[model samples]
Target chain A: MSAAPEATWVPRRYRVDAVRPELNDTVSLELAPAAGEAPAFEPGQFNMLYAFGIGEAAISLSGDPADRARLVHTVRAVGPVSRALAGLAVGASVGVRGPFGAGWPMSAARGRDLVLIAGGLGLAPLRPALLRVLADRAHYGRVAVLAGMRTPREVLFRAPLATWQGRTDLEVEVTVDRGDADWSGHVGVVTHLIPQLELDPRKATAFVCGPEVMMRHTAERLLTVGLEPTQLFVSMERNMKCAIGLCGHCQFGSAFVCKDGPVLRFDRIARALAVREL
Target chain B: MPERDAAEARLIEAPALQALIDALTARGYAVRGPRRRGDAIVFDEVARLEDMPRDCTTTQSPGRYRLADAPGAGYFGFSPGADSFKRWLHPPQQTEFRFRREGAAFVPIESAPAGVPRQAFLGIRACEIAAIGVLDRVFLEGPYPDPGYQHHRDGSFLVAVNCASPGRSCFCTSTGTGPRVERGFDLALTELHDSRHRFVVEVGSDRGAELVAQLPGRPAPAAAIAAARAVSARCAAAMPERFDRERVARRLRETPEHPRWAAIAERCLGCANCTTVCPTCFCTTMVDRTDLAGTTATRERHWDSCFTLGFSHLHGGSVRASTAARYRQWITHKLSAWLDQFGMLGCVGCGRCVTWCPAGIDLAAEAAAIGDEPGAPSGSDAHAP
Candidate 1:
């Protein structure tokens, strides 16, 4: 007899090994497959995380690509499905169907000066790429990480940021839109930090992730700083149901953000992004 | 090729159509054909030849559809209604998967009983046939194919019909998708409504030839062949080609900020009736439902439209929040971006969107207005975001 057909939408069970609250609304989950080891994923690939009786949401793999034992996702309590996923306790179960979409251009950026820019919760998708790059620190030249937050209180991965900041090999700069009493870092948008970086602009490759407006501004700023459009990448977010490209929810013009990207070269989508509401 | 020769240009009287239906039923196929449903003709199960609608045609225009009696015995006289083959194949709502909670882990449970009966679609129009081909490119040829769609489509048989009566909203001639069945069908029929009630059958597959062999028919005379060609030629004459595909696609790609979008949005209700009636609009959303005990949950995929506010929702809010933006996305995707994603154009010029739209918004007219000219920088007011 013929084998039963596979249902691509059905997700495998993953036990929540750990859950770390990043902020008032955001939480990071470490999930291990219920049966075997978690499937390996690339730096920028994402998973459709199902919250038990709740629906699924596309969350990027925020953990290290080198580690295959568990899949990490940082989710914010913004929508109904995300809220339920954020509140999951350790030992709870979540459905996962994933490792979908194109990954960051690590091979292309090899031996090139690396720059990473992120805004607000967009840092979650970029965290895995950073981790991969840091693991192989000798792969490239000068490296800089610029992050922007709404406020100091909303900064995610504080411990990791502090650890990376102390390293002499890396440059980590963070800014917030509003400063508080205890804050002493820059008090402006992330684009302001782009010009301050001292590097060979012609030799550097940058990856940006943030809100749409922030990404647009960051792309424009990087271009003005002598970085070519081909040397820059951006992670896009859209409403996704089936991350396999069957559902047309995450369409960004001709490209399906779930498949053709979550990580796309700036030059590939520059014209599409310029069109408002596309 | 032998089967093609055996069944090519066979002329069968109107009453002989029952033999084909009987042969399909004998092979455990559920024959679905058009029948009068209220004021419209819809595809429904027909156990006999008489069950299909006859001597009736539809009056279709922008935002209007009316069923009227035509002076003929043609069974496939009416143009398509709001209902398309999508309603049966993709379905408005379908169960994707079911899960049972076992302690801290959710285990996959068996879905509904399998063995979807083989379906034979009869009285399908040329435009509808092209729409099915478009869907095949989306669901079957993608990197990750949908099992549910494949299960429903695998054993299906299609019988295409040439439209002798073109409605006012019909423009298949423009898209080059219809008025006559070309390639993609198991069997094609051209109803000869002149002087006598007969059909010119062209077999497209082995199964179609086998079914035709069981029927009582004669080799089509020269007049029958000429008559069949005339049916399509007359349809093309009735409806002039609306817009040049390459020109409109290029124009749409260049002008996303056209002012015509905002003007069209003023009349568009964003009701999504156009997409609902569309044969190839294949956007869907997943809905999860659980029992009161919470032990089991079933996930269902429901038909969704790009026009819905929630279709483009993100964490903070929707991307295309304004109706104008949604309208631009839908039409631009259909006319231009679809070629970039899939090799073929998304629209087959079925014109159901024009007829079913509550606001009488004609997609062809809007596309021409926005896409016939060079790109203009329509200031900030034109940008919906």
Candidate 2:
């Protein structure tokens, strides 16, 4: 493939305007386009963030889509590329490839009660949808946010969560999977928080992002609570090499997690997800 | 004389094959045909017909391959090698782009999907042609067409050969891909070496007609057409229908926890050799490299296999950790999921995997094992190869 004839694979340069260290090994990077208009994207959409001398990883857009000047991505240093991306300094140049994949259902969920659930770093992708929902608050009914952190110290977007908690218009609940001596909050898996939620389950649109097993379990729990399987939406993650869907690394059976969805209705992917190792 | 509108056969002596090579070369086309590389037949650059394998025939079975000298036989008498057109069109390692540090930002400069060879691929088999067609559907017909695949594919020419002899592991007849090509060729030929060594040439595209018109040949009489059809028909009958692909795909898709997967796990090494050698497999993994000074970095795409543990890695670890699950994913994707994605079977019935597998794992047998009862003589032990 030495033949460099196409621009699809070439990453556009984006400067790191700001960096905020979050919970252990995670950082939120705020990027501004070094050239051209900032790419337009929706909630739950992601881009292939390329670190020079490393490689590329699919990172979701955590910043407000309305904010055209800045692009934000919250990343955890799990892999080599992610590690390099997390360690990048402000003003450092990074290659950015896309604003690809399906986003959360904002227009579709209008007039319906919404449940936004996140576990650990899964909050990054859902942050956009949360912003969109808050903006169009009058269009929807009760917005319930149930976020689960590994511990109180592991909570991402601490200031935003605290701000969300102050708003009486929405119900924001935070739990921890693990706790420290200073921690005095609910301690359990995210699924445990679902049963305690009191919403119009019949009209609620559930958006979940977390470990696949966690989503699977939470969806089952949501189903038990009266939300239709089709009403539940999931933001799925897989080993993606090409965010455009050609690489075949992000295939979830017939659906390409890169293109067909990073955001998909739970019913469509339930069967494929259950097939172990698929 | 009969109306010769493309399918009309033009006879060329086996020794005069060099004329065909010269014909392509004259048109600024690099002639890449099958030849001997070590012990296997591989596609390589050919200046003359002498470079093609003539006095050599190959034997292929599960986990075994042998090429012996067979004096005075026709050339191109073997199944495909590990390398398919993917090696040339997609490439193993390609520079996606070169990046240079521009102050605070890194600039990814252009250099991809360019310099694609303007090539005439000679001796492409019927199955290989179908594999190319399938790849076209994936790289071109998909939502985001791969620029690298489009540039190389659109510029290349194909010279397909109908298989006069089917290999031991071949099941093309079963898959309906074929011993005879009906589409996607510039020039299609059926080699006949019975009483006299000759090629029954059928001009396919406008380009094929031009090449044939330049050659010395008489209008092929009815007898020549009948003989050519007979050769392809014989080959079709020789290759057995190893699997019911229509039913197998559906069955494999429905049944995920079949005991057959656990059984095959005993023999499967997850070496990913099958995927690498497959004609239709097109997965790619990318890597980035920086120079010693770390000033410039280049993103490179490499041929990736699903068998790698890292291929399925997420935050904690890989989604597919077990060998049985990985094997199931490979076969199920090839047979069933591919149908759901591309509306076609991923396998073109090439037997390269069976011949190259280190543990003698035949896919046909695995196909039979799956979608069958728990124990009903799957033919996995029959040694169809």
Candidate 3:
């Protein structure tokens, strides 16, 4: 097979300036413009990050969009690429491609109560959107964030969580799949925390991300609590090779996850969701 | 009714035809013609006309094809090769975008680089021409035309040869494509042998007419036309039995929950060899490579297959996690759903799926098995024989 020429290639790059360990195997890297200006990307858009010789993986920007001086990507080590990404030190070189894919509809949720549900590392992408909503508190109604981690030790953004917990405008609840000896917070699945919240589901737009099973069950739970399918958005994950529509790898029925969304309404992909293997 | 003053052309002697290829190359066209490669005759750029396989023929079955030396010097030696017409159109990989870091911001860059040269493809069979039509409907006529594909297609010329020897795997006649060239070529050549050997050339395009005018030959007589028709008919007669694609599409669309899918899944490995060999399969993936400075990134488009496990992973889990589901998705999409989307049958009945399949899976048999059933026709086996 003849190699495709370079002119048609999409350039997706950002520069990494700092790295901080968050939890076991997970670290947060701060990025800035390596040379030119960083491409303006939406809150939910992800970038294809290349780890020198380790290969590429899609990572969502974890920092606020307005904070263009630096972009943050929080990643959990899983594959070779992610492992290499975790090992990079401060000022190490990491290639960035996109802030690709659709992000949370923050503008539409301005006056609506915001319910952010994140499971494990799924919290990484939702953090930026949550911060955006929290920053502009008067535009929205009740704001609640229900974050689920594997354990207390695995919880990410601990420092930010501390500050958000002190605020009266945001109701932050943390849960774990299982608990350790020192754990004192909610020790059940994240879904368990949803019932205790005193918010009107009709006025709420929930942004749920994390494990596929968790998101499905969470979306189901949100429906039971009266959130409309349209009012609920979920960040989807797939082996997204191209952030463009050309690659058929990330297709969910007729939609390309990399293009149409990494974030989609529950109603949009319900049928594909029900299928056993896709 | 034929136009009175329509330009007419006749075939040159075999030696003279070789000379024409040499002359064309001397004028700067990259000449890609049929030549013996390994076990098959494939199209490749050649420096001289002598590279054309002059004495080769292929035996084709519903799911098998093998090239062999012909009884004598037969110019139209074999059926189409394993490579599809899409190879020249939608190349396996392309760059859709590029980026360079200027200071701290990444800038989006897009351009179409020129490398593929203008060339003439010789001995393109009628079935191959039909395959090109299917691809044109996909890439060129789509809402977004592939710039790279359009560039190569516009630059290339075609010389279609009427099939005088049908392979066992060929069912082009049933697909309404060939045994003869009705359209979609610059020049259509029909090999004729009587007192002497020559190719009766019919110019289908203005380019073909101009080229024919330059050849050292005369307009063919009425007898030569009859011989060409007879040869085409003989090839058509040898086509393997084909299926009704319309009926197959209808049957498949009517029955999405069919038992045949599970049965086929039992045998399918989900390797996606069929799609890879298919002339019109156009799925791709993108990847980004950043420079050492991490300031610039180059995103690349690569060919991807649907059979892989990770193709349909969402936040919760994979939608099509089972081998059976993937196989069903591929078949249903190709025969039934594709018709709804593209307004044409996805398969051209080339039988490459049957011949190239590692497990020797026969698409015709599978389609027949499903289409024969009454439970809403689960798997539409509509294929042109």
Candidate 4:
């Protein structure tokens, strides 16, 4: 909350420069600040996107962190707020309040092999981290990107997935719960790909982002294979009214998912994540 | 009364009390104090000492609250009611900002031109004062501190009142937050029910000392100071049994799957009365309103409770769908998780939650039941100090 009204609850104006449809219900919006250059954001950090007459939804930055001209957010229209945001025209106005919450341990994962997993639209948040890692390919060791979707149609970043799969430095695995006739990928949960990944558990760090249950199962598998809880991180989501943590909507135990995390060490939240409906 | 020297205390009679209110009113502060409204003691504007509730105290228990007559008790006889100073500071519904759509962009409409008026809260109980401190950490000390809260907090003055009459449901004694005013007030008053109907005023700030100097008050005698301490001691002694704060917090964190929650949920109505009456429960939801043409919009933040299914709603559905889970979230967050969030328990032991619960749910009793369960790990290494 700065002295300026725009910094508080009043959001800064952002114009939609581009809109790329991912799925029937999901789209990626590239927003350039209505005024100065866009603010820099870290991978896994999110913004509270406000629609004109509707409300705000917490959407993660899905663009490359190094990109400074525009902010990109991938929104899946599951509620009124997200629907209003996702259906906006390219030239329409939107409200943005972020670069909030703790980001993925990019610096912590440096010099260590990485295991990045996503489930459903969960790929949207992980996109920035994946892009960051790919940009610095030589700075890290073996990189594994495993994705799980309900169906082949829900697969996001199809073009980038293809580009990453063509690279020899990265391991990209896509799995769908139910595959179509044209689908050539594995059909199972994302946790199934964990056992097949070829990396030393001690030297590797993992970042898992998905629905609650999926993150839990992925964490369990990662731990069983000897990836210490500190070596694995998960991004959590809840109803976030005040993304700055004043509104208690996003509190999961002591951690206000908006501030203390969106990305949290597995060990810190392992006990809380197991508690049903917390 | 909680932390003050006898030499610094002042004994003020009814005339001096009225003079203090008048002086604050002259200073452009909206002096708010407890007054009897309907069947409850609620806060309202106080123009004089008589405007406050007199010879009144409250009888409170689980699911019940009633105004009772205390023969010799003075204006500050009652324990805190459902409404707290939070209703004045962080109002239930406050307009965050208004916006008007002009072509493709939305422009923010300026709110009221004038700033919020300074406020002087009179008769704030010790627990309620502690609750304000908790809210300060919440809205003032966060990474992105709320400007509205900061403005209200900075412009406000606190006048704490030491508790001489402890309600049946009150547990400030157990929480170690009350029975006497401590460090957070400008002026603290302890009503002496002994011989004369007077107040023992303890000046806490320069403003308090200035006001006391102006008012007609004599230096408090040793007997008067002793009486104030005796009042607090008697109040604490009369309250319910005390439970170890660390033990209760640890039990709640360790036993997320405890059967006690389900049992409590069966009786819990999910009405959210407890949170509504709670002073430190600061969760809120944004209500966005727009005209029929959808050209203008206003976003208002309203008090929201964890009991509501919508409070935890996500894309698919609500995260905490069951009554059991919502209750668990509220209790765990208040008692255990708050320590991890703000380094103090969210509850001030004001007991509004217990007295106002429609289901007659006593959280202290429930916490004790869980803490007393066999094999529940016991340690002082919990989140609380």
Candidate 4 chain B minimal-lDDT segment of 10 residues: B376-385
lDDT per residue, candidate 1, A75-110, as tens digits? 999888999999999999999988899988988998
- Number of the candidate with higher lDDT, 3 or 4: 4
Off by over 4 Å in 4: A1-5, B1-5, B375-385
Interface RMSD score of candidate 3 = 9.0
Model 3 over residues B88-118: C-alpha lDDT tens digits? 6777776555556564334565554756777
Give per-residue lDDT, candidate 4, residue B179: 76
Arrange candidates, best TM-score first: 1, 4, 2, 3
Share of reference contacts kept by candidate 4: 0.68
Which lDDT tens digits does candidate 3 get at residues A1-278? 12233322333345568888898888998877667667677778898777653467889988887786777889888877789888877656666767677899999999999989999888888988987886788999999999998888888888998899999888999988889999889898999888788658789999999887799889888888888999999988877665655455665554567877899988877645644454
The DockQ of predicted model 3 stands at 0.17
* Residue B364 in candidate 2, Cα distance off native in Å: 1.0
User: What local lDDT does model 4 show for residue A1?
Assistant: 38
Error of 2 at B17 (Å): 2.0
Highest lDDT against the true fold, candidate: 1
Cα RMSD for candidates in order: 2.0, 4.2, 6.2, 3.1
Q: Model-by-model lDDT, in order?
A: 0.87, 0.84, 0.73, 0.87
lDDT of 4 by residue, B1-385 (tens): 2554558789988657889898888878899889888889988788887888888788899999989888767787777788878888788887788899999888989866348778999999999899998998888887778877777777577888889878888999778798788788889898886777788988888787777777788999999988988888888888866577899898888877767777888899999999998999888999998999999999989999999999999878998898988998998888899998889999889999999998899988887887788432322221211
Model 2, position A200: C-alpha lDDT score: 68
Task: Between candidates 1 and 4, name the one with more favorable DockQ.
Answer: 1
- Compute the lDDT of residue A5 as modeled in candidate 1: 40
Superior candidate under lDDT, 1 versus 3: 1
DockQ for all candidate structures vs. native: 0.59, 0.48, 0.17, 0.55
